[model samples]
Target: MKTRKRLRSLGVNMIACLLSLIMLIPIVLILLNSFKTSQAASDMSLALPVGGLHFENYTLVIQKGKLGVTFFNSLLYSSGSVLLCVILSALAAYVLSRNRSRLHRFIYVFIVLGITMPINFVSLMKVMQLTLLQNTRIGIILLYTAIQLPFDVFLIYSFVGKIPRDIDEAAVIDGCTPLRLFYSVVLPLLKPVLVTVMVLTFLNTWNEFVLPLYFLGSSSMWPMTLAVYNFFGMYVTDWNLVSADIVLTVLPVVIVYLLGQKHIVAGMTAGAVKS
Candidate 1:
Protein backbone atom coordinates (compact mmCIF):
# COMPACT_ATOMS: atom_id res chain seq x y z
CA MET A 1 0.00 0.00 0.00
CA LYS A 2 2.80 2.43 0.91
CA THR A 3 4.65 1.69 -2.31
CA ARG A 4 1.50 2.19 -4.37
CA LYS A 5 0.82 5.59 -2.74
CA ARG A 6 4.45 6.66 -3.25
CA LEU A 7 4.31 5.72 -6.92
CA ARG A 8 1.09 7.66 -7.41
CA SER A 9 2.59 10.74 -5.73
CA LEU A 10 5.69 10.52 -7.89
CA GLY A 11 3.57 10.27 -11.03
CA VAL A 12 1.56 13.34 -10.01
CA ASN A 13 4.72 15.30 -9.31
CA MET A 14 6.20 14.35 -12.66
CA ILE A 15 3.04 15.40 -14.51
CA ALA A 16 2.98 18.72 -12.64
CA CYS A 17 6.60 19.41 -13.62
CA LEU A 18 5.84 18.58 -17.24
CA LEU A 19 2.89 20.94 -17.29
CA SER A 20 4.97 23.72 -15.75
CA LEU A 21 7.63 23.27 -18.43
CA ILE A 22 5.03 23.34 -21.18
CA MET A 23 3.74 26.70 -19.97
CA LEU A 24 7.21 28.13 -19.22
CA ILE A 25 9.04 27.23 -22.46
CA PRO A 26 7.45 29.99 -24.53
CA ILE A 27 8.27 32.59 -21.89
CA VAL A 28 11.86 31.31 -21.76
CA LEU A 29 12.17 31.48 -25.52
CA ILE A 30 10.91 35.04 -25.62
CA LEU A 31 13.31 36.07 -22.87
CA LEU A 32 16.26 34.49 -24.65
CA ASN A 33 15.34 35.92 -28.05
CA SER A 34 14.75 39.37 -26.59
CA PHE A 35 18.50 39.67 -25.93
CA LYS A 36 19.69 38.51 -29.34
CA THR A 37 20.23 40.56 -32.50
CA SER A 38 17.30 40.90 -34.91
CA GLN A 39 18.87 38.36 -37.29
CA ALA A 40 19.68 35.93 -34.49
CA ALA A 41 16.27 36.19 -32.88
CA SER A 42 14.51 35.62 -36.23
CA ASP A 43 14.52 31.83 -35.71
CA MET A 44 13.17 32.32 -32.17
CA SER A 45 15.40 29.46 -30.99
CA LEU A 46 16.11 28.52 -27.38
CA ALA A 47 19.86 28.88 -27.98
CA LEU A 48 21.59 31.75 -26.17
CA PRO A 49 22.75 34.81 -28.07
CA VAL A 50 26.25 34.42 -29.51
CA GLY A 51 27.44 37.93 -28.68
CA GLY A 52 26.68 40.41 -25.91
CA LEU A 53 22.98 40.91 -25.22
CA HIS A 54 21.27 43.48 -27.41
CA PHE A 55 20.12 45.63 -24.51
CA GLU A 56 19.11 48.33 -27.01
CA ASN A 57 16.14 46.21 -28.02
CA TYR A 58 14.38 47.22 -24.82
CA THR A 59 15.28 50.90 -25.17
CA LEU A 60 14.10 50.94 -28.78
CA VAL A 61 10.95 49.08 -27.85
CA ILE A 62 10.22 51.57 -25.09
CA GLN A 63 10.70 54.53 -27.41
CA LYS A 64 8.95 53.14 -30.48
CA GLY A 65 6.28 51.29 -28.48
CA LYS A 66 5.42 54.48 -26.57
CA LEU A 67 5.68 52.34 -23.47
CA GLY A 68 5.98 55.40 -21.22
CA VAL A 69 2.55 56.69 -22.18
CA THR A 70 1.00 53.22 -22.49
CA PHE A 71 2.48 52.06 -19.21
CA PHE A 72 0.83 55.03 -17.51
CA ASN A 73 -2.39 54.26 -19.35
CA SER A 74 -2.33 50.64 -18.19
CA LEU A 75 -1.51 51.65 -14.65
CA LEU A 76 -4.38 54.11 -14.57
CA TYR A 77 -6.93 51.70 -15.98
CA SER A 78 -5.81 48.81 -13.77
CA SER A 79 -5.59 50.87 -10.61
CA GLY A 80 -8.98 52.47 -11.18
CA SER A 81 -10.64 49.16 -11.94
CA VAL A 82 -9.00 47.42 -9.00
CA LEU A 83 -10.09 50.19 -6.65
CA LEU A 84 -13.67 50.22 -7.90
CA CYS A 85 -14.02 46.45 -8.15
CA VAL A 86 -12.65 45.71 -4.69
CA ILE A 87 -14.70 48.30 -2.84
CA LEU A 88 -17.95 47.64 -4.69
CA SER A 89 -17.57 43.86 -4.65
CA ALA A 90 -16.74 43.83 -0.98
CA LEU A 91 -19.72 46.02 -0.11
CA ALA A 92 -22.13 44.11 -2.30
CA ALA A 93 -20.91 40.76 -1.03
CA TYR A 94 -21.17 41.87 2.58
CA VAL A 95 -24.72 43.14 2.20
CA LEU A 96 -25.92 40.15 0.23
CA SER A 97 -24.25 37.63 2.54
CA ARG A 98 -25.58 39.24 5.71
CA ASN A 99 -29.13 39.76 4.42
CA ARG A 100 -29.80 36.23 3.12
CA SER A 101 -33.13 37.35 1.68
CA ARG A 102 -34.58 35.86 -1.49
CA LEU A 103 -34.00 39.09 -3.41
CA HIS A 104 -30.39 39.23 -2.26
CA ARG A 105 -29.97 35.59 -3.28
CA PHE A 106 -31.47 36.33 -6.67
CA ILE A 107 -29.16 39.29 -7.14
CA TYR A 108 -26.17 37.18 -6.15
CA VAL A 109 -27.17 34.46 -8.60
CA PHE A 110 -27.71 37.00 -11.38
CA ILE A 111 -24.28 38.53 -10.80
CA VAL A 112 -22.55 35.17 -10.64
CA LEU A 113 -24.16 34.14 -13.90
CA GLY A 114 -22.13 36.88 -15.56
CA ILE A 115 -19.06 34.77 -14.98
CA THR A 116 -20.27 32.43 -17.74
CA MET A 117 -22.13 34.93 -19.91
CA PRO A 118 -20.73 36.10 -23.22
CA ILE A 119 -20.41 39.85 -23.55
CA ASN A 120 -22.43 41.58 -26.25
CA PHE A 121 -19.89 43.93 -27.68
CA VAL A 122 -22.40 45.46 -30.08
CA SER A 123 -24.71 46.54 -27.30
CA LEU A 124 -21.71 47.54 -25.22
CA MET A 125 -20.39 49.84 -27.94
CA LYS A 126 -23.78 51.40 -28.38
CA VAL A 127 -24.09 52.09 -24.67
CA MET A 128 -20.57 53.46 -24.50
CA GLN A 129 -21.35 55.77 -27.38
CA LEU A 130 -24.64 56.84 -25.81
CA THR A 131 -22.93 57.62 -22.53
CA LEU A 132 -20.20 59.63 -24.33
CA LEU A 133 -17.55 57.41 -22.70
CA GLN A 134 -15.90 56.12 -25.83
CA ASN A 135 -12.18 56.69 -26.36
CA THR A 136 -11.77 58.03 -22.84
CA ARG A 137 -9.68 56.83 -19.88
CA ILE A 138 -12.58 56.79 -17.41
CA GLY A 139 -14.63 54.85 -19.91
CA ILE A 140 -11.98 52.18 -20.26
CA ILE A 141 -11.54 51.99 -16.51
CA LEU A 142 -15.27 51.63 -15.91
CA LEU A 143 -15.46 49.03 -18.68
CA TYR A 144 -12.78 46.96 -16.99
CA THR A 145 -14.56 47.32 -13.65
CA ALA A 146 -17.81 46.00 -15.13
CA ILE A 147 -16.02 43.14 -16.87
CA GLN A 148 -14.28 41.98 -13.66
CA LEU A 149 -17.07 42.70 -11.16
CA PRO A 150 -18.92 39.41 -11.45
CA PHE A 151 -16.06 37.08 -10.59
CA ASP A 152 -14.82 39.43 -7.90
CA VAL A 153 -18.25 39.45 -6.30
CA PHE A 154 -18.50 35.68 -6.46
CA LEU A 155 -15.10 35.17 -4.86
CA ILE A 156 -15.80 37.66 -2.08
CA TYR A 157 -19.31 36.35 -1.50
CA SER A 158 -17.98 32.92 -0.66
CA PHE A 159 -15.34 34.34 1.63
CA VAL A 160 -17.88 36.60 3.35
CA GLY A 161 -20.16 33.64 4.07
CA LYS A 162 -17.36 32.08 6.09
CA ILE A 163 -17.06 35.00 8.50
CA PRO A 164 -18.89 34.74 11.85
CA ARG A 165 -21.97 36.90 12.47
CA ASP A 166 -21.03 37.48 16.08
CA ILE A 167 -18.53 40.10 15.05
CA ASP A 168 -21.25 42.11 13.35
CA GLU A 169 -23.51 41.83 16.37
CA ALA A 170 -20.77 42.98 18.68
CA ALA A 171 -19.99 45.94 16.45
CA VAL A 172 -23.66 46.90 16.46
CA ILE A 173 -23.79 46.59 20.25
CA ASP A 174 -20.91 49.03 20.45
CA GLY A 175 -23.00 51.72 18.71
CA CYS A 176 -21.31 51.32 15.35
CA THR A 177 -23.24 52.49 12.32
CA PRO A 178 -23.71 50.19 9.35
CA LEU A 179 -20.83 51.84 7.53
CA ARG A 180 -18.66 51.65 10.62
CA LEU A 181 -19.55 48.00 11.19
CA PHE A 182 -18.54 47.09 7.67
CA TYR A 183 -15.55 49.34 7.25
CA SER A 184 -14.07 49.21 10.74
CA VAL A 185 -14.86 45.63 11.74
CA VAL A 186 -15.77 43.28 8.94
CA LEU A 187 -13.44 44.88 6.39
CA PRO A 188 -10.28 44.00 8.30
CA LEU A 189 -11.33 40.36 8.54
CA LEU A 190 -11.70 40.22 4.78
CA LYS A 191 -8.02 41.11 4.13
CA PRO A 192 -7.07 37.79 2.56
CA VAL A 193 -9.97 37.72 0.14
CA LEU A 194 -9.65 41.44 -0.55
CA VAL A 195 -6.02 41.01 -1.46
CA THR A 196 -7.00 38.12 -3.71
CA VAL A 197 -9.65 40.22 -5.42
CA MET A 198 -7.28 43.17 -5.86
CA VAL A 199 -4.54 41.03 -7.36
CA LEU A 200 -6.91 39.20 -9.69
CA THR A 201 -8.65 42.37 -10.77
CA PHE A 202 -5.35 44.16 -11.39
CA LEU A 203 -4.00 41.29 -13.45
CA ASN A 204 -7.18 41.02 -15.50
CA THR A 205 -7.36 44.73 -16.18
CA TRP A 206 -3.66 44.89 -17.04
CA ASN A 207 -3.80 42.00 -19.51
CA GLU A 208 -7.09 42.97 -21.10
CA PHE A 209 -6.73 44.11 -24.72
CA VAL A 210 -10.06 43.36 -26.35
CA LEU A 211 -11.99 46.04 -24.50
CA PRO A 212 -9.37 48.69 -25.18
CA LEU A 213 -9.12 47.61 -28.78
CA TYR A 214 -12.86 47.94 -29.38
CA PHE A 215 -13.36 51.10 -27.35
CA LEU A 216 -10.15 53.08 -27.45
CA GLY A 217 -9.90 54.49 -30.98
CA SER A 218 -7.07 56.83 -30.14
CA SER A 219 -3.52 55.52 -29.98
CA SER A 220 -2.61 58.05 -27.29
CA MET A 221 -5.05 56.38 -24.86
CA TRP A 222 -3.95 52.83 -25.65
CA PRO A 223 -2.70 50.49 -22.93
CA MET A 224 0.43 48.34 -22.92
CA THR A 225 -1.32 45.50 -24.71
CA LEU A 226 -2.46 47.77 -27.53
CA ALA A 227 0.97 49.34 -27.65
CA VAL A 228 2.49 45.89 -28.01
CA TYR A 229 0.06 45.10 -30.82
CA ASN A 230 0.99 48.26 -32.67
CA PHE A 231 4.66 47.62 -32.04
CA PHE A 232 4.33 44.10 -33.44
CA GLY A 233 2.72 45.43 -36.60
CA MET A 234 5.47 47.98 -37.22
CA TYR A 235 8.33 45.61 -36.40
CA VAL A 236 6.98 42.33 -37.69
CA THR A 237 10.38 41.27 -38.97
CA ASP A 238 12.33 42.61 -35.98
CA TRP A 239 11.86 39.67 -33.64
CA ASN A 240 14.23 41.02 -30.99
CA LEU A 241 12.31 44.26 -30.53
CA VAL A 242 9.03 42.37 -30.58
CA SER A 243 10.28 39.96 -27.93
CA ALA A 244 11.57 42.85 -25.86
CA ASP A 245 8.18 44.56 -26.03
CA ILE A 246 6.44 41.33 -25.05
CA VAL A 247 8.79 40.88 -22.11
CA LEU A 248 8.19 44.39 -20.81
CA THR A 249 4.44 44.01 -21.21
CA VAL A 250 4.43 40.78 -19.19
CA LEU A 251 6.86 41.97 -16.50
CA PRO A 252 4.39 43.89 -14.32
CA VAL A 253 1.89 41.03 -14.28
CA VAL A 254 4.60 38.55 -13.32
CA ILE A 255 5.82 40.74 -10.47
CA VAL A 256 2.30 41.40 -9.16
CA TYR A 257 1.30 37.71 -9.25
CA LEU A 258 4.50 36.60 -7.54
CA LEU A 259 3.98 39.12 -4.77
CA GLY A 260 0.36 38.15 -4.17
CA GLN A 261 0.61 34.44 -4.97
CA LYS A 262 0.55 33.25 -1.36
CA HIS A 263 -2.41 35.47 -0.46
CA ILE A 264 -4.28 34.30 -3.55
CA VAL A 265 -4.01 30.63 -2.50
CA ALA A 266 -4.84 31.37 1.12
CA GLY A 267 -7.90 33.40 0.15
CA MET A 268 -9.25 30.84 -2.29
CA THR A 269 -8.86 27.94 0.14
CA ALA A 270 -9.89 29.78 3.28
CA GLY A 271 -13.58 29.59 2.42
CA ALA A 272 -13.38 25.94 1.41
CA VAL A 273 -13.20 24.57 4.99
CA LYS A 274 -16.00 26.77 6.43
CA SER A 275 -14.26 28.06 9.50
Candidate 2:
Protein backbone atom coordinates (compact mmCIF):
# COMPACT_ATOMS: atom_id res chain seq x y z
CA MET A 1 0.00 0.00 0.00
CA LYS A 2 2.83 2.39 0.82
CA THR A 3 4.51 1.71 -2.49
CA ARG A 4 1.24 2.14 -4.39
CA LYS A 5 0.56 5.49 -2.66
CA ARG A 6 4.06 6.70 -3.49
CA LEU A 7 3.60 5.73 -7.14
CA ARG A 8 0.26 7.53 -7.28
CA SER A 9 1.79 10.67 -5.76
CA LEU A 10 4.67 10.61 -8.23
CA GLY A 11 2.29 10.16 -11.13
CA VAL A 12 0.21 13.13 -9.98
CA ASN A 13 3.29 15.30 -9.61
CA MET A 14 4.51 14.35 -13.09
CA ILE A 15 1.13 15.19 -14.62
CA ALA A 16 1.02 18.54 -12.82
CA CYS A 17 4.49 19.45 -14.05
CA LEU A 18 3.55 18.50 -17.60
CA LEU A 19 0.44 20.68 -17.47
CA SER A 20 2.39 23.60 -16.09
CA LEU A 21 4.93 23.32 -18.88
CA ILE A 22 2.22 23.08 -21.50
CA MET A 23 0.80 26.41 -20.32
CA LEU A 24 4.20 28.00 -19.80
CA ILE A 25 5.72 27.05 -23.17
CA PRO A 26 3.63 29.52 -25.17
CA ILE A 27 4.50 32.38 -22.79
CA VAL A 28 8.16 31.45 -22.99
CA LEU A 29 8.01 31.37 -26.77
CA ILE A 30 6.39 34.78 -26.91
CA LEU A 31 8.99 36.32 -24.61
CA LEU A 32 11.87 34.78 -26.55
CA ASN A 33 10.49 35.81 -29.94
CA SER A 34 9.89 39.35 -28.74
CA PHE A 35 13.67 39.83 -28.53
CA LYS A 36 14.59 38.09 -31.78
CA THR A 37 14.87 39.55 -35.26
CA SER A 38 11.73 39.51 -37.43
CA GLN A 39 13.21 36.69 -39.56
CA ALA A 40 14.20 34.70 -36.52
CA ALA A 41 10.75 35.12 -34.91
CA SER A 42 8.85 34.20 -38.05
CA ASP A 43 9.26 30.52 -37.26
CA MET A 44 8.10 31.07 -33.65
CA SER A 45 10.47 28.34 -32.48
CA LEU A 46 11.71 27.40 -28.99
CA ALA A 47 15.24 28.47 -29.89
CA LEU A 48 16.66 31.64 -28.36
CA PRO A 49 17.69 34.68 -30.35
CA VAL A 50 20.87 33.85 -32.29
CA GLY A 51 22.43 37.31 -32.08
CA GLY A 52 22.04 40.28 -29.76
CA LEU A 53 18.42 41.09 -28.81
CA HIS A 54 16.40 43.27 -31.16
CA PHE A 55 15.32 45.74 -28.50
CA GLU A 56 14.00 48.04 -31.24
CA ASN A 57 10.99 45.69 -31.65
CA TYR A 58 9.48 47.03 -28.44
CA THR A 59 10.13 50.68 -29.32
CA LEU A 60 8.70 50.22 -32.82
CA VAL A 61 5.68 48.46 -31.42
CA ILE A 62 5.06 51.18 -28.87
CA GLN A 63 5.18 53.80 -31.62
CA LYS A 64 3.31 51.97 -34.40
CA GLY A 65 0.81 50.28 -32.07
CA LYS A 66 -0.08 53.60 -30.44
CA LEU A 67 0.36 51.80 -27.16
CA GLY A 68 0.64 55.03 -25.14
CA VAL A 69 -2.97 55.98 -25.76
CA THR A 70 -4.16 52.41 -25.46
CA PHE A 71 -2.25 51.88 -22.25
CA PHE A 72 -3.88 54.94 -20.71
CA ASN A 73 -7.28 53.77 -21.92
CA SER A 74 -6.79 50.33 -20.38
CA LEU A 75 -5.58 51.84 -17.12
CA LEU A 76 -8.55 54.16 -16.96
CA TYR A 77 -11.10 51.47 -17.66
CA SER A 78 -9.52 48.98 -15.25
CA SER A 79 -8.97 51.42 -12.38
CA GLY A 80 -12.40 53.00 -12.77
CA SER A 81 -14.14 49.65 -12.92
CA VAL A 82 -12.10 48.28 -10.02
CA LEU A 83 -13.01 51.24 -7.84
CA LEU A 84 -16.69 51.09 -8.72
CA CYS A 85 -16.96 47.33 -8.43
CA VAL A 86 -15.18 47.15 -5.08
CA ILE A 87 -17.18 49.91 -3.43
CA LEU A 88 -20.57 48.88 -4.86
CA SER A 89 -20.06 45.17 -4.34
CA ALA A 90 -18.80 45.66 -0.81
CA LEU A 91 -21.76 47.84 0.11
CA ALA A 92 -24.28 45.54 -1.52
CA ALA A 93 -22.78 42.41 -0.01
CA TYR A 94 -22.53 43.87 3.46
CA VAL A 95 -26.17 45.00 3.43
CA LEU A 96 -27.54 41.78 1.99
CA SER A 97 -25.48 39.62 4.31
CA ARG A 98 -26.50 41.61 7.33
CA ASN A 99 -30.18 42.12 6.54
CA ARG A 100 -31.26 38.56 5.71
CA SER A 101 -34.70 39.85 4.71
CA ARG A 102 -36.72 38.04 2.07
CA LEU A 103 -36.37 40.86 -0.47
CA HIS A 104 -32.69 41.26 0.17
CA ARG A 105 -32.28 37.52 -0.23
CA PHE A 106 -34.10 37.63 -3.54
CA ILE A 107 -32.01 40.55 -4.76
CA TYR A 108 -28.80 38.82 -3.76
CA VAL A 109 -29.82 35.67 -5.61
CA PHE A 110 -30.80 37.67 -8.68
CA ILE A 111 -27.45 39.46 -8.74
CA VAL A 112 -25.45 36.29 -8.14
CA LEU A 113 -27.41 34.53 -10.87
CA GLY A 114 -25.87 37.01 -13.31
CA ILE A 115 -22.63 35.08 -12.92
CA THR A 116 -24.04 32.34 -15.12
CA MET A 117 -26.10 34.59 -17.40
CA PRO A 118 -24.86 35.05 -20.92
CA ILE A 119 -24.58 38.60 -22.21
CA ASN A 120 -26.65 39.52 -25.23
CA PHE A 121 -24.33 41.96 -26.95
CA VAL A 122 -26.91 43.27 -29.39
CA SER A 123 -29.33 44.27 -26.70
CA LEU A 124 -26.52 45.54 -24.55
CA MET A 125 -25.27 47.80 -27.32
CA LYS A 126 -28.77 49.09 -27.88
CA VAL A 127 -29.05 49.94 -24.19
CA MET A 128 -25.72 51.69 -24.26
CA GLN A 129 -26.70 53.67 -27.33
CA LEU A 130 -30.01 54.64 -25.79
CA THR A 131 -28.15 55.88 -22.74
CA LEU A 132 -25.78 57.90 -24.95
CA LEU A 133 -22.79 55.89 -23.75
CA GLN A 134 -21.58 54.28 -26.94
CA ASN A 135 -17.97 54.99 -27.90
CA THR A 136 -17.43 56.89 -24.66
CA ARG A 137 -14.72 56.27 -22.04
CA ILE A 138 -16.91 56.44 -18.95
CA GLY A 139 -19.43 54.21 -20.70
CA ILE A 140 -16.83 51.51 -21.22
CA ILE A 141 -15.73 51.79 -17.61
CA LEU A 142 -19.32 51.39 -16.44
CA LEU A 143 -19.77 48.47 -18.81
CA TYR A 144 -16.75 46.76 -17.24
CA THR A 145 -18.18 47.37 -13.78
CA ALA A 146 -21.50 45.80 -14.77
CA ILE A 147 -19.76 42.84 -16.33
CA GLN A 148 -17.66 42.22 -13.17
CA LEU A 149 -20.28 42.93 -10.51
CA PRO A 150 -21.82 39.48 -10.22
CA PHE A 151 -18.69 37.60 -9.27
CA ASP A 152 -17.43 40.51 -7.18
CA VAL A 153 -20.67 40.60 -5.22
CA PHE A 154 -20.66 36.85 -4.72
CA LEU A 155 -17.07 36.79 -3.48
CA ILE A 156 -17.58 39.69 -1.08
CA TYR A 157 -20.94 38.34 0.05
CA SER A 158 -19.38 35.12 1.25
CA PHE A 159 -16.60 37.04 2.97
CA VAL A 160 -19.05 39.42 4.63
CA GLY A 161 -21.03 36.49 5.91
CA LYS A 162 -17.93 35.29 7.70
CA ILE A 163 -17.45 38.57 9.59
CA PRO A 164 -18.97 38.61 13.06
CA ARG A 165 -22.01 40.85 13.66
CA ASP A 166 -20.87 41.81 17.15
CA ILE A 167 -18.50 44.37 15.71
CA ASP A 168 -21.32 46.02 13.85
CA GLU A 169 -23.47 46.08 16.96
CA ALA A 170 -20.71 47.56 19.08
CA ALA A 171 -20.06 50.27 16.47
CA VAL A 172 -23.76 51.16 16.48
CA ILE A 173 -23.72 51.33 20.27
CA ASP A 174 -20.85 53.81 20.01
CA GLY A 175 -22.98 56.18 17.89
CA CYS A 176 -21.37 55.21 14.60
CA THR A 177 -23.42 56.15 11.59
CA PRO A 178 -24.13 53.51 8.95
CA LEU A 179 -21.52 55.01 6.66
CA ARG A 180 -19.00 55.29 9.45
CA LEU A 181 -19.65 51.75 10.56
CA PHE A 182 -18.98 50.38 7.11
CA TYR A 183 -16.10 52.66 6.07
CA SER A 184 -14.20 52.63 9.32
CA VAL A 185 -15.07 49.24 10.82
CA VAL A 186 -16.24 46.82 8.17
CA LEU A 187 -14.15 48.07 5.25
CA PRO A 188 -10.91 47.67 7.17
CA LEU A 189 -11.83 44.12 8.05
CA LEU A 190 -12.54 43.48 4.34
CA LYS A 191 -8.96 44.23 3.18
CA PRO A 192 -8.23 40.71 1.98
CA VAL A 193 -11.41 40.30 -0.02
CA LEU A 194 -11.26 43.88 -1.30
CA VAL A 195 -7.73 43.38 -2.57
CA THR A 196 -8.85 40.18 -4.26
CA VAL A 197 -11.76 41.97 -5.90
CA MET A 198 -9.56 44.86 -7.06
CA VAL A 199 -7.02 42.54 -8.66
CA LEU A 200 -9.67 40.40 -10.37
CA THR A 201 -11.64 43.40 -11.61
CA PHE A 202 -8.52 45.13 -12.89
CA LEU A 203 -7.45 42.04 -14.80
CA ASN A 204 -10.90 41.47 -16.29
CA THR A 205 -11.32 45.05 -17.40
CA TRP A 206 -7.81 45.32 -18.74
CA ASN A 207 -8.06 42.16 -20.81
CA GLU A 208 -11.59 42.70 -22.12
CA PHE A 209 -11.64 42.75 -25.91
CA VAL A 210 -15.11 41.96 -27.20
CA LEU A 211 -16.98 44.73 -25.44
CA PRO A 212 -14.75 47.42 -26.91
CA LEU A 213 -15.03 45.92 -30.37
CA TYR A 214 -18.79 46.12 -30.21
CA PHE A 215 -19.39 49.31 -28.25
CA LEU A 216 -16.37 51.47 -28.98
CA GLY A 217 -16.36 52.65 -32.59
CA SER A 218 -13.45 55.04 -32.24
CA SER A 219 -9.95 53.60 -32.47
CA SER A 220 -8.61 56.35 -30.24
CA MET A 221 -10.59 55.03 -27.27
CA TRP A 222 -9.48 51.43 -27.74
CA PRO A 223 -7.87 49.59 -24.83
CA MET A 224 -4.62 47.60 -24.88
CA THR A 225 -6.32 44.36 -26.00
CA LEU A 226 -7.89 46.03 -29.00
CA ALA A 227 -4.70 47.88 -29.68
CA VAL A 228 -2.79 44.60 -29.69
CA TYR A 229 -5.37 43.06 -32.02
CA ASN A 230 -5.13 45.98 -34.42
CA PHE A 231 -1.36 45.90 -34.14
CA PHE A 232 -1.40 42.21 -35.04
CA GLY A 233 -3.46 42.92 -38.11
CA MET A 234 -1.26 45.77 -39.28
CA TYR A 235 2.01 43.93 -38.64
CA VAL A 236 1.00 40.38 -39.40
CA THR A 237 4.38 39.48 -40.86
CA ASP A 238 6.44 41.14 -38.14
CA TRP A 239 6.22 38.42 -35.53
CA ASN A 240 8.88 40.03 -33.33
CA LEU A 241 7.01 43.32 -33.18
CA VAL A 242 3.72 41.51 -32.54
CA SER A 243 5.30 39.51 -29.76
CA ALA A 244 6.70 42.65 -28.22
CA ASP A 245 3.28 44.29 -28.35
CA ILE A 246 1.71 41.29 -26.70
CA VAL A 247 4.31 41.37 -23.93
CA LEU A 248 3.75 45.05 -23.27
CA THR A 249 0.00 44.53 -23.14
CA VAL A 250 0.27 41.72 -20.59
CA LEU A 251 3.10 43.22 -18.50
CA PRO A 252 0.94 45.37 -16.24
CA VAL A 253 -1.42 42.50 -15.49
CA VAL A 254 1.49 40.23 -14.62
CA ILE A 255 2.97 42.79 -12.26
CA VAL A 256 -0.34 43.39 -10.51
CA TYR A 257 -0.97 39.66 -10.06
CA LEU A 258 2.51 39.10 -8.70
CA LEU A 259 2.08 41.88 -6.16
CA GLY A 260 -1.36 40.77 -4.93
CA GLN A 261 -1.07 36.99 -5.33
CA LYS A 262 -0.62 36.40 -1.62
CA HIS A 263 -3.70 38.47 -0.82
CA ILE A 264 -5.60 36.51 -3.44
CA VAL A 265 -4.76 33.19 -1.79
CA ALA A 266 -5.55 34.44 1.70
CA GLY A 267 -8.85 35.98 0.63
CA MET A 268 -9.97 32.91 -1.30
CA THR A 269 -9.21 30.52 1.57
CA ALA A 270 -10.21 32.76 4.49
CA GLY A 271 -13.58 31.21 5.30
CA ALA A 272 -13.43 28.21 3.00
CA VAL A 273 -13.61 25.60 5.79
CA LYS A 274 -15.39 27.62 8.48
CA SER A 275 -12.46 27.05 10.84
- Candidate 2 lDDT over 109-181, as tens digits, reads 9999998999999999899999999999999999889988988998899889889999999999999999999
Query: Residue-wise lDDT of candidate 1 within 95-214, one digit each (tens)?
Result: 998897899999999998898999999899999999999888999999898888888898889888889999899889999999999999999999988989998888888998999889
Model 2 scores worst on lDDT over the 10 consecutive residues at 266-275
Worst 10 residues of 1 by lDDT: 266-275
lDDT of 1 at 116: 90
**Which residue runs of candidate 2 sit more than 4 Å off their true CA positions?**
1-16, 265-275
Predicted model with the maximum lDDT? 2
lDDT of 1 at 29: 96
